[model samples]
Target chain A: MAATASLQTAPVPEGAPITVCEVGPRDGFQIEAAFIPTAKKIEIINALFASGIRAMQVTSFVSPRAVPQLADAEAVLAGIDRPEGALITALIPNLKGAERAAGCGVDAVHTVVSASETHNLKNVNRSIDASLKDFEAVFTLLDNSGIAVEGGIATAFGCPFEGIVPPEQVARIAKRYQDLGATSVGLGDTTGMATPATVRAAVRAIRAEAPGLGIGLHFHNTRGVGLACVMTGLAEGVTHYDASVGGLGGCPFAAGATGNICTEDLIYLLNESGYDTGVDLDRLVGAARLTQATLGRELPGQVLKSGPRLRRYDPGLTATAAG
Target chain B: MAATASLQTAPVPEGAPITVCEVGPRDGFQIEAAFIPTAKKIEIINALFASGIRAMQVTSFVSPRAVPQLADAEAVLAGIDRPEGALITALIPNLKGAERAAGCGVDAVHTVVSASETHNLKNVNRSIDASLKDFEAVFTLLDNSGIAVEGGIATAFGCPFEGIVPPEQVARIAKRYQDLGATSVGLGDTTGMATPATVRAAVRAIRAEAPGLGIGLHFHNTRGVGLACVMTGLAEGVTHYDASVGGLGGCPFAAGATGNICTEDLIYLLNESGYDTGVDLDRLVGAARLTQATLGRELPGQVLKSGPRLRRYDPGLTATAAG
Candidate 1:
């Protein structure tokens, strides 16, 4: 009875559209061993935009020496057609990267601060405190640039180096981001260690600490609970999510980490659950196919492999209806 | 506030241990292309038992011509060491298979009825009504055998040919099984089209139709929502779940059907969410390894590849504490 009651209470309200922030260009491609040509990256980003993804993390403005794969970030930013009203964001690590992203005219710049000190050091070559200090300067750079700042706390759910990050610690970091002029903050399951319980607890903690700040969830399917975590996040009223096109991307530092939540898969789930994602399933699958072609490999995405469940075929029904 | 309230109400009740019914030996091996030796099958079942799986579907007593993979059901049943208090179940197609399973000393026999008439014809080479008629004789054979009966309704969520299966149809079939002397009924997502909403609706419908009957859920990771469906099932208070070691098992008839939910992955989720599965993670991983070795291919299970998340290692803490 309690279970049924809970289900009734958490029903997805009619026509409540959720925003799926595509991170394939940034998160998904960052781990590639070979450098994807700048033109190809632009083509994929434009394809995603055509597929009705209005919000996306296009590329990261990091040191070329650090991540050679994303070395053409500036070229990609300049080459792609940025449709009016689209929110194009870029990941920035420090003040220099933020300045570079701002100059590239991104709608928003995302900065990262891991909850675990070890992970933060491994990810950005700086401690969490040092990253926060760096963010102060980065935030100052975007003060009058019309660029929104988003703070992403990596390893917010669980860390590869520091497992089972405390919800209080994540809350504190999120609250600090709010205090530092971030428009929103995202909880990153860096190693895909997030369970439904952990996702719910993190949401509650973050919401409690920063009441009006927008919260997004970034999940990986490494241990195969990415979408489950997303479901919990949805029940917690989280409408923003970060996903890759073909379930691409893996954490280089985290052992066994593989693939963010697949974009088409997440969109399929949202659409089936009666949430409007504004993304066309067919076009999205096309983009996923392009991603596979660009990478010249099979992707981990399912919808691209298995098309959406069609309506039942009736012999009496016309071919048009069946089609 | 509503999201937080919903989460609080649905918190996994303290100390409510969930039963994970391991179906790897039956479901996993049934899909293998190679004929696994009877001794290897028994060895895997024993290894699963050693991993603290108290209940398992060991083998299927189907026609050897129909499914040669499970032809050695009697040999596997006779060879394995059936631990005390373990529920050793076997799949039975009809009266003959049920009689064979009963004679072979299986603690229970599972019979399947597809909700979709098309799938029923394809699977059992009989109509739904014909299967029901056959079940009558099978029930009579088990009338006083002291062996329990479990009815598995395939395509209870959706069918490959029929597409969406109405909740009422699944409920009607489940109620029929309950009326025909089944101790419990499992709703099989044969084509993996089940969403959280559908799962909740099916649970509600079945509970309404067959009050006080045990309900179990069988899911496929075809579209990568198997674990998510499991989460929704857990929220709806359905404890018993069917999973395969190494994520083995695929519906040969269902297009694009992939592996079943991995046993180790499911155990990891249950354990992290505070549900006692009575399964040792290490031993279960070992069993998954054995499954891979027997199959001679990599399986889809993740926890078998990625170890459980360990706590943050502190330099001040001892190695044992860190470990």
Candidate 2:
């Protein structure tokens, strides 16, 4: 267990509060080919909240024709329970999406801008500056409506098309978002290109630029280091994290691969590391199992399959040979 | 990408050296139900060496009747290629296994003892003290044979049956191994129960108790925090790690799940973080693909499916919609 050889890091604080925001219904479901029924989506969301999940990016408000998977965003928002202290949010593309989300009474809306130019153009069919310009209107619409806005910078780690995004570029966007009244800014590992070094650089740059904005890490477990990135995030003192249930999403480029980090797995890590996530592991696993069954596929969530670490076994069970 | 927050870890040094040892053939293959052909095993072992793996636990010298899958351990040792600087080792149960390993010209031998009494009794059918008594003969046989000995403490973190395996229990075993001429001690996450707290505690205890013994970390990604555990190891300044190709192994208790941390993913994290591993990720992926093809089912490695983080795409392919 002694891993002391390189990378001298300070101790990770125990008993700290980490906000594990569930983005499964939006980020995880957006790429799923099958449209989960509106009622089913509400059931899953309600289950998550019952398990002590306080912050969640519940769904995305987009054009139904463009993304039919989330065409029932408003229905899902209406059908779900409003638990005390639960912060329900959604991803919004433009002013229309923002208006729809506000009408549905969401607590907040997330806005994204890619750090790299080419990726920005491909993802949203607009330049980074144009996306920012469009967000100004969305921000204004929700300014006095009690809806907090979180600015999400996609491809903040590295862009597949334009590798090694500079930390300064991400910081500039964060500065703009802060100036536009964003309560927090999230760094999205859109293609799972985030590494410890890149994460350190981008985090340090943003802290130097926008000291007032809260930082949330939204990482994808694409390359198997998603939770490892979360480890770095915890070390860096960032509390907010984004995860999906049962690892429901897959990358558009990497077919049949996991997308965002699994929510159950994230909670397991946080709870074990002495960070208070306020989640019940059994209930969260149940939620993950529900998602996996609803999707009719094997998920990439290891904890959900393995159960909790201390889960006992009968020694009499066979196949336990080692030598 | 910015992850600065709670843990005040110092800077992770770039361009440092980390020794990533492959244990797929031994710890991984021993658990497989089907017996891989000797030639195929040799091919996979050779491919791993060709990909610049400097250290490996090639096979185990247990009774053929005990573990049929690894019955051809001697044949595998004889048939595989040994490139210069590749340290080949194997698991030895007792003096007889040590003698067989010495006969196979292994560079080292790893001996196992569970930190928990129940797990020890279930794993090797002996009490903890009885297992140590058995290892005494192993150390004596390999003392002057030019084969280094590594003590492996199973369930060093926590145990499924016993719940929590105290760090003192693990360190006491490590001290016994050190006193018995073991050059290093490896803390094994046999049931994927290692957390950062347990890892830190065990590592600190060993360092305090046996200052001269080198430490190696053997972690399982069963609960999805295996790589995160590695992050803790790096911060603690320990360099040696054990992994499996394609994440071939699965926990015996958890049906159809990943066991060891993926070698390719570990190499990718280490290499991207500026640690020198001398591994070509593409070659490692090729090796994983070979294992997957050989197994005729999917393995749990994420980098094996997602490729390297900066892997480029043409954007001409469809399904790239986002906002």
Candidate 3:
């Protein structure tokens, strides 16, 4: 198929991998039962950077008690020395978080609001309008500090509390974020309730509503539809995606909610489908194995547990192949 | 999208749920390690039937030592007494197996051959030509004995051992089975290597080769493309599908292979998409629970653990309200 007009046409350097943002430290850690140490969080961020994932979301700057897992966000940012040209993003839930992210000399501050009213109220204890008001200030503060601002629309696909969320509503919210000078908009499957049809429809509507705004898809594999949703986004000309390292993370309200799509598996799918997701599968596996060892548990990522699809028989060459 | 020929023109009664054949007890169990007892096998099949799944694959008649899981196949067939209209199928690998299936009074005898020569050799321990020769007698016996015969093409999509089985080759093998008077044919993704593009190509090719034979898709969820393959099959006008209860089956060769597409999940998808799958989601979950309890282990179906998209609240009132 010809390249769709919605995708950026800037030709990638021959065989260069697509830029995959590893959100395990942020998205994955934020939902876990254990409060991972800032030092270990820094180790994960550095490991992911070494894995060829240039873009990483290391920590969320929520209130210390709200997501205790990320209470040491500042310490994590202080400990890690990022590579040149690497983008490290932090999830900023309010103006306070945005100020901290800007002060940390981070590449980006990402603020999340929900498309569903019930979820928005349940998530941040604020109405949608109240959350938007907070985000507006966060955007302005980040812009004045010359830091990039990414607005995330949670429950962009569907809401567990309120069943189906209209695509137009998601687009409307995203457009408002763009109007407020956000650099990019991320669509999140907060509840893992998206089908390929719904994902495509929402992405198409968002693109039409906010032209030239980079739209990224963040999915949870709750219903085992994470990669399928990613494929839908890919078919709709989306290149940027957010994946957790070991499929770690779950929505507090979505019953039986699972983790985000595994980075290794997502990279495998993209590589197999002939996309350039510039991630090294082996390196991602190494990071996952490290995280798994740290946590003393097996993760849900298939590729990490099963190994890469094709194993080559070379005594000297250690390169594994895709299935 | 407008309904295709099967959806638009099938002569079945209006509002009747489409049938899904649960193949877990038979096809799934035969391949893997879990050696479930005859009582447990009957329990699983009975639970599935109670879940509004009228048809199921109860067992396979391969040699006892070859597949020890179904060693008590005859006992399993004799044990379960289900609804009158409910049909149970048995997979028979050769003429002796078919004779046993006929003696056991199965509703259908399913014989499988491979589309790829290398896959056939690896799978059945016989070449494609030898398998065809064996299937000829099986088909002839079924034709004379008034037993329904369904032909399955293993590795119809692609093979792990032998890459990318040609569509024409699949059609040719399917035609040979049809010529021998097989009543229907099922395209097997033995390795779960099918994509939408490949499924569309193979289905279209096979339809042209054998217009009268009913074609079903038996897919594995190994590569996470099972549902995508199903959608392609649905688009190509296929009405019958074979899924395992709780996604039970996987290819022995494919180490990371999860089970086949779960029957409850597939039904949920079809129902949500406005297609009618007669199985009740809650009842399907109940069946999955029973199987899991019997085996004392967790199975892979997600919808069973997590309630259906449409949760039932005030069940008694809802039933009365429907009345």
State which candidate has the highest lDDT. 2
Model 3: lDDT of residue B98: 92
Residue-wise C-alpha lDDT for candidate 2, range B102-214, written one tens digit per residue: 99999888888999899888878899999998899888887777888988888899877889998989989989998998878888898788888788888888888877678
Q: What is the interface RMSD of each candidate, in Å?
A: 8.0, 1.9, 9.3
TM-score for all predictions? 0.92, 0.95, 0.83
lDDT of 2 by residue, A1-323 (tens): 00100111333468867788888888888877887899899989998998988888889988899889999988898899988877888888899999999999988888888998988888888899999999999989988888888888998998878888999999999999989988688888888888888887888788888886778888888899998898887777777888988876667767656788999999999998888889999999999888888888888898888998888887776525442
Q: Tell me how many clashing residue pairs each candidate has.
A: 0, 19, 4
- lDDT tens digits by residue: candidate 1, A1-323: 00000111243464676788899898888878889999999999999999888689999988899779999999999999888777889988889898889889988988888898777766666778888988999888888778888888888888766677899999899899989987688788876788888888887887788777778888888777888888787777777888999888764433443578999989888887788888998899899999999999988787777777553544332211000
Each model's chain A TM-score: 0.91, 0.94, 0.90
Off by over 4 Å in 1: A1-14, A253-257, A311-323, B1-14, B253-257, B311-323
DockQ for every model comes to 0.29, 0.57, 0.14
Which whole-number lDDT from 0 to 100 does residue A249 have in model 2? 69
Model 2 chain B: lowest-lDDT 10 consecutive positions: B1-10
Judging by DockQ, tell me the better candidate of 2 and 3: 2
Residue lDDT tens for model 1, B17-118? 677888888887876779998888888899999999878889898889977998989899989988877788888888999989999998888888888887
Q: Looking at the true structure's interface, with contacts defined as alpha carbon pairs within 8 Å between chains A and B, what fraction does model 3 recover?
A: 0.06
